[model samples]
Target: MGTNRWKKYKIEMLPIKEPTEIEELSLENLVDQILNAKKLDPNADTTALEREIDQMVYQLYELTPEEIKIIEG
Candidate 1:
């Protein structure tokens, strides 16, 4: 039998969010989703998720072009 290294932690499959649903997520919810994604698969590619988070932040802050340029840099 394999060692139960994660015995104390409960593991369950997270629901996959559709693109439209993801687009409507609040910033706090989006952050939670990102954290859960990382918890589920640290090595998995999260570029798309990160991109969505960036988009949400940009919208929330309503940053100007100069601010965005500075932040992007």
Candidate 2:
């Protein structure tokens, strides 16, 4: 079973402009934004960002949710 260890991980909210800036951008710009996301907010919501990245990957590879679950697990 999962423990409370996950709760110890720090999380922070992102500035609205940063997410808006990253949306609908070119691939190159997207990469740049990802690298600079934390720079925009050191305590940003990284878990959400990570999930966003997973969603991106799933879309890029055209993988189903089940496939992603297997891969993640």
Candidate 3:
């Protein structure tokens, strides 16, 4: 029998840890936290999250740039 080029592999993944506490937070608050935290961590995806929030707010409230800036700031 010829040696197999591809070997069978078993991959073990680590279990994910859940947050210690679940707090009731609004989406806006969550996004704001993400944005602020991203300033410290380069890997955080705050920009994409912010864009999603922007789209959501536009659909729901039709917020202007000034209004959005005021909220975000």
Candidate 4:
């Protein structure tokens, strides 16, 4: 019963594949790519991503939430 419980609790590990192509870009380039892709894509996910980006940008730029709300309004 103990052995059976141990077997049942054992985790199966799967092989993980590393990505073949990974390109590292500057933060500016990354932001540009994200914004451009968001502009091109008209999906709900894209809009949500854009909103997240906007919040990050505002925080990084030291803009207040009130300022953002004003601009957004």
Worst 10 residues of 4 by lDDT: 16-25
> Candidate 3 has which clashing residue pairs, if any?
none
lDDT for each residue of candidate 4 in 4-45, tens digit (9 for 90 to 100) = 444533544533333223222333455676768868884525
Q: 1-73, model 1: which lDDT tens digit per residue? A: 7875554334435433444455565655767877888899988677887887787767656778788889989
Which candidate has the top score in lDDT? 1
lDDT of each: 0.69, 0.62, 0.61, 0.57
Give the candidate order by descending TM-score. Answer: 1, 2, 4, 3
Off by over 4 Å in 2: 1-34, 40-43
Which stretches in model 4 have alpha-carbon errors above 4 Å? 1-45
Q: Which tens-of-lDDT digit does each residue in 1-73 have in candidate 2?
A: 8775434334334222233334446445555666688789877665765667667656666789899999999
CA lDDT for candidate 4 = 0.57
Candidate 1 structure lDDT: 0.69
Candidate 1 error regions (>4 Å): 1-25
Per-prediction TM-score, please?
0.49, 0.44, 0.33, 0.40
lDDT of 3 by residue, 21-54 (tens): 3322445577778868878896876776677656
